[model samples]
Target chain A: MKSANIQLETLVCPSCTQKIDGALKSLDGIKEDTLKISFATSKVRFDFDEEAVRIEDIEKAINKVGFEVIKSRVK
Target chain B: MQRFIFRNKNKIALINGILIALAFIIRWTAGYMEIFTGLLVAASILGLIPIALQAYQALRVKVVSIDVLVTMAVGGAFAIRNFEESAIVTFLFLFGAYLEQRTLNKTRSAIKALTEMAPETAWKLMDDGEFEEIDIDDVDEGDTLLVKTGAKVPVDGRVLSGEGSINEASITGESIPVAKEAGSGVFAGTLLDNGTLQIVADRVGEDTTFGKIIELVEEAQESKSEAERFIDRFSKYYTPAILLVAILVFLFTRNVELAVTILVLGCPGALVIGVPVSNVAGIGNGASHGVLLKGSEVIRDFSRLDTMIFDKTGTLTQGKPSVAEVQSYGDGIDEARVFLASIERESDHPLALAVLDEIGETDYLEVTDTHVVKGGGITASVGGCRVIVGNQALMTEEGVPLSEQVREDMRRLERSGHSLVLTAVDGELKLLMGIRDPIRPGVADDLESLKKLGVKNLVMLSGDNQGTVDAISSELGLTRAYGHMLPEDKSAYVKDLIGQGEIVAFVGDGVNDSPSLALAHIGIAMGSGTEVAIETSDVVLMNSDFSRLPHALGLVKATSRNMIQNIVIAVGVVLALLASLIFGEWMNMSIGMLVHEGSILVVILNGMRLLRYKLRPSYRLGSRE
Candidate 1:
C-alpha cells in the first residue's frame, strides 16, 4: 500500500502559469512514513497506507502548499 | 440551494440541504408504490445535475472535488433502495457547492470593490476642446481631461491648470484635503473638493492607477483560502478512499447493503464544502468593510502571527515636527535680536521658517558657508562671530564650553520630547533652539487596544538613534524596540523573525521601509505612503489610522476561524450522514438532505458573522481585586 499522503499540483496564485514552488520546503507531519506527497498531479493524487496516516492528514499537507486536493480517480 | 446561492454561502448551504431532503422524500416515498409519489425524489435527482457538472470539472482537472463524495453518498443510497437518503445526499451536496461558491466570491471581491470606487465615465476632451462623456477606461494617456467639483480624477496624472483641495481619502487614504495646484499629482479615484482642473492623463485602461489597483486585487482573489486549499487536496484522495473502504467492507462482510451504506455515509459533500464556503464568506466580509485580504492563505497565516512590528516615523508617530523653544546668550549680543535676524533670513528649512514666523522675518546680512546635514541639523557663519550651529554633538565637536546655564537648560530640554540645536559664535556659545517631532494622536489608544487584543509583541523599528526610538517606544509602553536600523537591516531583521517561526507582520510607509514590508508575513502599507511601499505590500491600509493594523489582524483571525469551522462542519455532516446509512439506518434521502443542507447553513452562517467584526465593542467590567 502506498503512503496515505496526497498532493495537488498548481501554479502560484496569479504569478504565472509556471508550477507552484516552495514557501515551506518541509511541512508538519509530511515526514511520517505512512504518508508521501507529490504535486505532479494537475489536480490531485493521493496514495495512502490505511494504517499510517488518516485521509485528513493528506488533506492537511496539500493545504499547507496553497493548493486544494479535490477528487481523484480510483486506480 | 437557489435561495442559499443568492443569499451567499450560508444561504446556498441551506438551500442545498433542502433540495437534498426533497430528493430523499421523492426517492423513498415512491418505493415503486406509485410513479406520481416520487416527485420529491425526482427533484433531488434533477438537482444533482449541477453538482455533478462541478464534479465532472473536478475530474477533468484530475482532482476529485467534494461534489464526487456527495454524489457517491447519494448514489449509494439510491442503489440501496433508500431513495430518500440518496436524494438527501445530492441535495446536501448542492447546498455545499452553493455555499462554497458564494463564500469564494466574497473573499475575491477586492477587485470588484475597487472597480466600483471610480465613477463610470470621464469628461473627455474632444477635438474642438469641448468636454464630452467617455467611458473611464477609454480615456487615453496624455489626453487632457476636465474634472469639476466632486468628480473623481479619471487617471493618475498631474494637473496642468486650476488649483483646489482634493479629498484623497479613497486612494491614498489622506483624509485631509490636499491642495492641488498646477503640477500637483493626482490619482484616479480622488474627489475634487472645489476647483475644476485640467489634467494630463499619464495612464489609461488597465495601465491606470485604478486599473493597477483592480489587477492587484484580482490577483489576490485568485489565490485559494486556507479552507479551500484543504478541501481541494482532501477531495482528491477522499473520494477514492471512501470507495475503497466500501469495496473492502463488502469483501469482508459479504454484505452489499453494508457496502452501499458505507458509500452513502462516506460521501464528503458537507466536509468538502465546509471550509471553502467559510473562507469565501470571510473574504466577502473583509472586502465590504474596506479590508482586502488577498486570499485564505493570508487569513490562515495571519492567525499564527506572534509579533507585530512598525516603522516609527510615519507608521507610529506623526512625521510632522515644530520648533519648541529658543534660548540665546551671546556676550556681543542682544539675546534674541541678533540670532533671530540671522536665522530668519539665511535658512530655507521648515524649522527656519517656523523660527522666522515665530519672530518677524527680520532682515539680516547673508550668512556665509551654509552647510546642511541631511538627517541632522544645519550650520552657517554669521557677523564675524564664526557661528557654529547644530545639535549638541556638533557643538561639543567644536569644543564650545558648556556653561552652568547652558548645561541646566540642555538637560531640561532633554527631559522634554524635543530636538536641541546649539549655535556657537566665534568660539562663544550663542543660541539653543529645541524642536520636536510630535506623537500622533490616538496612537496610544490603538497600541493599548492591540495589547488587549492579544498581540504577543509590539515593537517599533526605526533608523533613528536609540534615544529617539526608546523615547517614543517607552512613551507608548511597547516592550520590544529596535533602533538605528538601515533599510536593509530592517528587512533582514523581519526576515530573521519569519525564519524563526514567528509569523511577523511589518507595517511601513516609505521607500526606506519597502524591503522590510515585503519580507513580513503581512506587509501592511500605509495608504498615504510613497508609491514604492504601496507596490511592495501584501495588504494596503487605505487609511493611515494606526488602529487599522490591529483591526486587519482581527479580521484575519476571524476569517481563519470561520474557515476551519466550515471545514469541520462539512466533514462532520458527511460522517453523520454516512453513519445514519450504516448502523442507525436512520437516513432516507429527505432526512439526509435536510441534515446536509443544515450543516452547510451552519458553516456559512459562521463565516458570515465575520462581517460583524468591529473596531471597538462595549465590555463587561472585570472582577475587582
Candidate 2:
C-alpha cells in the first residue's frame, strides 16, 4: 500500500469532515486504519493499494461528498 | 448533476442569498405579497439543493451530518408552507458555511505558506559541465546542484564551492541570512541571498529537513488534543441526543415549529470546531517563531508545567568549554599534552574539545581500547600506556594518588567554579586541566521570566561538582541545585518531582540528558543539541535561544485560555438559544439559526487571535552581558 496526502479546499465545519471521511473510508482499496481527515488543515491522509484503486478515485469520492480536492501527493 | 452542483456550490448559495434578500424586501414593502412568497419558496429550494445533495451523499455513506438536520428542517418548513422561515434558514446556513470557509482558510494560512514554499525545480549540475533545470523529485542524493542568488536551494546539501549568505527561514524559522562557505550545510527551500554556489545534495524530497518540518507541522495539526477528542465524542452523542430531544418535543407538544427550532439551536457547530481550530493556530504560531511544538497534547501539557528542571551544561550554559589553565604534574608536560590531545581527539565531549583547542595541531598517538566511563570521563591505552582522562572520581576509581600539590591546585580550581579534568598516566597523576564553560547570556533573565510566568520550582541538575553547580545556581538564583548527577540520577530526580504532583519540564541539550528529557512531563530540547536530545524532546527551540523559552510558555498559556473561552462561548450560546426557545418563545427558527451561525464565527475568530499573540519581552539584567 502507498501513502497519499490529499489537500482539500477549506472544510467549513465538522459535518463536512465526517462526510468526506466516510466517503473516503468506503472506497475499496483504502486502508481504513490509516485514514485521517483533518478539519483544521482540510487534509486527508490515507494509505491505499495502487493496483486496486487510484488517487483519482479517492478524489472523486471526496468530490462526491461536496468537497474540492486542491492537490494530492503520493509517498 | 453532482459535478455541476459541486462546482457551483458557492454561486448557488450566493444566488439563494440574493433571493432571500429580495423576499425580505418584498415582505417589508408589499405586506407578504404572492411575489414575495414565490421568491421565498424559490430561494428555499435553491439553497436546499446543495444541502439536500450533501445530505444524500452522507446517507450513502451511512453518516448523519449537519446538512442532514438542516435539510430536514428546511423540508419540514416547506411542507408546512412556512416559506419565509424556510428561505431564511437555508440562506443563513449557506451564508454561515461561506464565512466559515473563509475564516478557516485564514487559520490554516500558516501551513499553506509552508506548502507553497516547497521548491519545485532545481538546477542539477549536468555531466556536460552545464546546469540544467530539473524537477526537484528527479534531483537525487549526491547530485551537485547550483544555487544562484535569489533562488531557493532545492535540496539539503553541503556547499562545495563559492560563498554566499542563505536565508534559512523556511527550514529553521530564523529570518536572518547566514553566510555559507565551503563545507557549510544548506537546506532546501532556503534562498541564497547572494553569491553563487555549487552544492552536493545530501537529502532530497521528503528526506530534507524542510520537508520533515512540513510533514511534522501537518501531523501536529492533525493530532487532536484531549479536549478535542472529548468534544468529538461529545458531539457524536450530542448530535443524536439533540435529534431525539427534537423528536420528543414534537411528540409531547405537537408543535413542529418549536421542535425544528430546537434542532436548529442544537447543531453543536461552534463546540465541535472550537478546540481543533485553537490547536492548529497555536501550532502555526509556534512554527513561524522557530519553535516546533509536537502536537496539541504537548502544548496542553506544557501549559500546566509548574516545575522546570534544567540540565546544566548545554541548556543553561553555552555548552562550549575553553581550557582556562593546564598544569602538568609530572616532568613530561609535553608528553602529557600530546597524549591529552590524541585521546581527546577520539571524543566529542566539551572538555575534550577544550583540550584539543589548547593543544592545537598535535601528532596523533596510536590509542586503542577506548571506553567511556559514564558521568566520569574516558579510559584508553595510548602509546602502550594506560591513560585515563576524566574527572576527580575517575582518578580515585583508577587508584591514581593525587599529590598534595596537585590536590591544592584542584581545590583552587573547584572553588573558582572551574570543572577539573585530570589526566592519569600509568597509575601516576600527570596533569590537571581547569575547564570552564561560561553561563549563557540572558539565562538569568530567562529564568526570572519563567518564574514570573508561573514556574514555581526552578532547579538545576548537573554532573558537575558541588562547587560549580552551587556557584552557578547561586548566580542564577535557582530555587535548588543538584550536583554530581548521572543520567539515571537526573531521570530519578525528575520522577521524584513528578511523584510530588508537580508537572516537570526538563530542558536539556545533550545525549546523556535524553533520559531525563523523556522522563519529564514536557521535554524541551535546545536546537543546537545532539540529535538524540532533539528526537526525545516534545518541544524544540530551533535557535537554542533561552529568551524564546518564556515566549513559548506564554504561547501555550494563551492557547489554553483561548480554548476555554471558546468552549464557554460555544456552550453558552447553545444553552441561551435553547432556554429562550423552551420558555419565552423569543427565538424563532430564523433567529435561532442566525445566533447559531454567529456563535460559530465568534469561536473561530477567538481561535484566530492566538495566531497574532505576541510574547512579552524577557526581563534583561542591568549589564546586558
The parts of candidate 1 lying over 4 Å away from their true place are: A1-75, B1-112, B225-230, B240-267, B278-292, B327-338, B341-345, B348-388, B392-402, B415-417, B423-431, B495-501, B527-530, B615-625
Q: Clashing residue pairs, candidate 2?
A: none
> Across residues B564-592, which tens digit of lDDT does each residue of candidate 1 receive?
67766776677667666756755454565
lDDT of 1 by residue, A1-75 (tens): 443322343321111111122211233333334222321112332344545555565554344333455543222
RMSD for all candidates, in order, please.
11.0, 5.8
**lDDT score, residue B402, model 2?**
90
Candidate 1 reaches a DockQ of: 0.03
Model 2 chain B is weakest, by summed lDDT over 10 consecutive residues, at: B616-625
- TM-score of candidate 2 restricted to chain B? 0.82
